[model samples]
Structures are given as structure tokens and as C-alpha cells.
Target: MGLRLLIIVALFLVVEIYAYQAVRTLFKPKWLLISYALISLFLLVYIVYSFMQFDRAVGQTQHTMFVMGLMLLVYLPKIVITVILLGEDVFRLGASLVNYLMYNLPKNELMPERRKFVSQLALGLAAVPFLSLLYGIFEGKYNFKVIKQTVFFPDLPDAFDGFKITQISDVHSGSFDNHEKINYAIDLINDQETDMILFTGDIVNTHATEMHPWLNTFNRIKKYKYGKFAVLGNHDYGEYVTWPSQKAKDDNFKGIKNLYGQIGFDLLLNEHRFIEKDGQKLALVGVENWGKNFKQAGDLNKAALGVNQNDFKILMSHDPSHWEYEIKEHPKNFHLTFSGHTHGMQFGIEIPGVFKWSVAEYIYKQWAGLYENKGRYVYVNRGFGYHAYPGRVGIMPEITVIELKKGSNVG
Candidate 1:
């Protein structure tokens, strides 16, 4: 996760840096210098803290310093955004221009005469935490989103036109302390005129014991016709948390699987199930964590057992890389696959044309939207819940409704 975060922050800094460069000519480079210096300081602290976070055995010295460092960076955006919007839109805009400069260039002690900028820098840094707190408010309610694509197979019958499949992925159950906030998300999904509901992995975090409290919240989900199904994410097994005995870990996996069953979902561990209506069967194959970086234990060949290759198939794998690395080149092409590991770096622009260039581009070409490989379709969901960061800036929580239309050509 450290490497993942490093990649994400690096991506964010790249955009922020370039955005700063665009406005450099407009602001005093000295102000730009100070503002830039502030950003570098934050980034340096962030990098140090990040390293501290990744090194578990580094004792509290590095951990404490690192965490304290990250605590400030997390709030810097709020400060930047707030300062840019103060009193009037223009003044705030000016602040924003300055803030970008600060983030791009860390200007300190370079010039003896530029001492007046220190007050603005200090003031800006002071608002970081408050800005982050304000940013949290943006996540309180339902946000309208654009579903990038609707996949279709030639054999799909007309009965399933605009078939809405609400997909939620990366719900790290252990991360949630408040059930009401979770219910809000669930209510959002239930209220949608969705056809079937599918959760693509990470149903629970670690031991099954961590999931007992939130069963009621997840069970509140309601919708139109088809039932619910899910597969295992990388965190499903309790690997991060140490157990007294290996048996404890084994029992945790068992309990988590039972919890999945309890939540009214079919835990598809490298297996296929058919969702049929009006005598037309649509094959849905789900495999346990088949990511390029995470776990590669699931077998797509076994998942497709007894299911004919000619049938219209929709696969549910966790990460987008799986589709790129495995499914797209499989012997039998899956018409559509739903995945949600990207969460869109949880905070990058995903507006189709431009979203492709973001950091997510370097990793998964089809990070948080839809892509077609050869002729097959894959939808990378933007996740239902947030993780370690606890907030989303660009790629919001997604409630996907896939509309499947019958195609005349089945070849």
C-alpha cells in the first residue's frame, strides 16, 4: 500500500506541479517561490511519513515523525482551496494561484528581502486541517455520476435492455466505525432502479470478527429483480493482522465466508452462476482476487467450468489489471466484466477524454471507467467506500447500473 500511495501522491504532485507552472507568469515568482517552498516542505514530510508507514519494524521514532508529517499534508489541500476562495472569488482565486506555486516550488531563505511572504505562508499552513475538515462536508450526500459505458453482447435478449447492475467494490468493512454513514451509501444504492447488485471483492477486512457489527447496514440494500453476488478481495483473508495461531487465521477466513453468505450474497470463489430471465441465461463468473499485484490464486478456467464458451459471459474480477493481463487474452472471450480495484486513485479526474492521462493511466489503462479489449468489455468501478485517506476528491463513490442490450450478431 505504501508503494501504491507513493504512486498516487506522485501523480497528484505532477498535475499540481504543472498546474502551478501554468499560473507562474501571473503571480510574483517570490510569492510563487514561498508557496512553492511550502508545498515541497509538505511533500518532503509526506514522503518521510509515507516511508515510516511502509516500514512496520521501524519502531515509533520514524512512525511518529512520519505520521505527524502526513497529518499536515492531508490538510494542505483544504488550506489551499480555502485561501483561494476567501472574502471574494477573485481573492480566493489569487490565493489559489499562489497555493499552486507554493506546492510546486518550495521557496525558503533564497532571498533576504522577501520576508513579508512568511506571514501568508504561515497563515496558509494554519488552515490546512480546517480545509480538510471542510472538504469532508462534500462527501455527505449523493453525488450524480456518469457511467462511462454500457456493455452489450450479441446474444443478450431484449428482455434485459438497460439492465442496471449496481456494483460496489473495495468495501473494507474494518475501516468503518459509523454504521449510519454506511447506511447512507447503501440507501443510495437501494434507491437506484437497479436490476442486479454485485459486489466485486474486499467484502470484509481481515478476520471475520471485524465484520459482525455492520451486517445490518449492508443488508439494508434493496433493488428490483436479480439477487446479489460477490468474490473475495485481497483483504478478505486476515493476513495483515497477526493471529495467535494459524488456526485462528483459518477460522477467520471461514467466518468471513459465512459473513458473506449472511449478507445475502453468493460468495463465488472462482466459479460461475447464471442469471437467467425469460429463458435466456447470462453467465456471471466471479473469481477470488486475481489482481496483477495483489493475489493471483483464482483460476478463470475453473470458473468457466460447465459454462459454454458461446454463452454471453460477464466476469467479476477485483483489479483492472486482471482484465488486461488475463481475461482479454483468455481462450474464451468474456462479453463483459465488472471490476473496482482502482477507486480511481480515489481522487483523480475521470471525465473520459482527460482522465486517461492521470497517474492511473500508467498502471491500468482502463483505471476507473470502461474499456474494451479486442472485442470484450470491462468496467472498472470507482469503489463504494473510501480507505486510509478517508476522503475522495475527484473519483467519487460510484453506484454503477449497467445496461445490457441484446446484439443481433453473436459471433
Candidate 2:
């Protein structure tokens, strides 16, 4: 552990040195440089100290969230600077080596001076993320977007063809700091007037008590006509934090489950419910938190027990990996699945349909929006709240409204 920590610190210093070169070249005044170095050092010490003080039992308090946010805000832009400067150094080195071979240059002439223009360009480019991250911390986390998607399924029941469902996932109520913003988001959900609403997990960061203050706010979600339902996500299990006792952990788990009920949602735990419309019924199967890398508590087979193989089913599973690894290939065909765990990494570039990219794509194939596999579809919500990072970048908080269409999509 000590050696690993040393290596990490060493690498961090290397990045700082490269990043500093850009600042040093851009700003010539000694006092200004000294001030920049001192500020950077202070941030480094504070971040390291706060992380060392992390309490597993307490878990995800506001102080820790603030630290996490500060760390990202301070370093992500620096990383961009470091990368650009490092690449320039590599080019300079190659040019120097060639010059030395051709002209027999002195040792002092092995490398040329850093270009002011390059440094200026690096700083200018870095400003994009720096300012963007700052805005994310203050405003983007609550920048709710109502994304509407219409999916066509041949197997969809005629009566339910035009049914609309609103999905909001990964609430992470524990991290909410502004009631006004949350209230506005809730109102946005209610405004949609969808036939049904579904919440796909991570109701709290770890402790269920984190949601105590927002029970009433969530309960104001206004009941939907076909009913509101939800399923658990990985974080809802309270497994990330250490517990004082097994009973304590169990009690928190129970409280978390009850939170859904408090908000008037039928919390489905490896269960199935039928939503009927005009004599035709559609199965809504929900499973507990199931992830390819996290827990595997969701029992899809058991959840769909009574539902027929021919019945049109909509599944609610917290992690999209459940669909990727198992649900997509299951014998009991699920026409549609709802999931939200990646949160688009709370950072990325997204432009309606023209372009979309995120770090989350490397981890989750169905990270943000809708995906299809041989007619079966999965819509992964980009989360309705922020967690560890305490903010969101390009991927804003989402309120997904999905319309069910009976016929093939028109191209």
C-alpha cells in the first residue's frame, strides 16, 4: 500500500510538472508563478488529506462530495494541459535528436525553448472543460432534460400501443443539496402526464436515512393512471459502506426499500405486475439490483415466472449489464428493458442525434439512450441525480418519456 501510494504521488508530481511548464511559459512574473504553485500545492494537500480521512461507516457526506468535486474541477483541466504539453515535449525531443545527429549540436542545444503560442493554445483549450466543470458544479446537476423517445415493437399489445411511460433513474437522493431544483424536476416529471412513471434505482447513496428529508417532495410526484413502479439499483443494497452491525445494515436496507413505498411507488423485488388497458394486459417485470461487475441479486427467471413467453413484457432492471449479459438472450422474451447505472459518467459530449460520446461508453454499451438487439430494446436513463462527483458535465439529469408504438418504425 505504501509503495502504491508513493507511485501514485510520483505520477501526480510528473503531471503537475508538465502542467506547470505551460503556466510558467505563459506567465513570466515570479510572484505570480509562486502564487500559482502555492495554490496548487494547497489543493493537493487538502485533497489528499480529505481522502485519507474518508470514513467507511459514515459514507458520502457533503464534505466528501465537495472534496470529490473540488478534486475533479482542479485536476481534470490540468490533465488536459499535461497531455498537450507532454505531446509537445515528445515532438521537441524527436526534433532535437535529429538536429543533434545532423549538426553535432552542444548538450545545451538538445531541446528548443517551449513555444508561447503552444502554451497559450493549451490554456485556451483547457478553459472549455474548466469553465464547463464550474458550471456543472453550480447549475448542470439540476439541469433537467425531458428526453422523449418513441419505440416500435411488433409484439406490443394493440391496446397499449400508444401508452407513454416516464422513467427517472439513479435518484441518489442522498446527494441532493437544493430542494428548489429537486422540486422543479419533480414538477417536470408530473408535467409530462405520462400514463405511468418508473424509477430504476439508487434511491440513496448508501444510508436510507439520507432520503428522510425528501420523502414528501418525492411523494408529490402525482400518481399516474396506470400506476408508478420501481426496481433496485446496485447502490441501494448498502454494500459500499461498512456497517456497525449486521442488524444495522439490514435495518438500513429495509428503510431504503420502504422509501419507494413512502413515495407511492410499488417497489418490486424480483416480482411481476400486470398493467391492463382495455381488456389487454402487459407484464411489467422488475428485478433487484443486478450488475455484471456488482451484485447479482436480480432473479430475472423468477421475476418473470407467471408471465407467458408470448406475453409482451417490459422489464425494469437497474443495471444495463443485466440486459447485455443475460436478459437479452433469455428464453422469456422481454420486449423492452429500463436501466440506469452508468449515469453517462456524469460527463461527456452529447448532441441530439448528430454526435454523442462519453467515457461511459467504454464501460457500458447501453450507457445513455435507447439501444436495440434483434427487436428487443433497452433504454438506459442518464440518471436523475448526481453522486460521487457531485456534479454533471455534458450529460444533464434526465426525465425520459417513452412512447410505445405498435408498428415498425418509419425510416
lDDT leader: 2
Question: How do the residues 200-268 of candidate 2 rate in per-residue lDDT, one tens digit apiece?
Answer: 999999999999999999989998999999999999999999999999999999999999999999999
Clashes of 1: 11
- Per-residue lDDT tens digits for candidate 1, residues 324-389, read 888988888888888987767655555546534446677777787777766788888887765555
Residue 228 local lDDT, model 2? 95
Cα shift from native, residue 29, model 2 (Å): 1.3
For model 1, give the 10-residue run with minimal summed lDDT: 109-118
Candidate 2: misplaced stretches above 4 Å? none
Please give the lDDT score at residue 311 for candidate 2: 94
Looking at model 1, residue 258 earns an lDDT score of 88
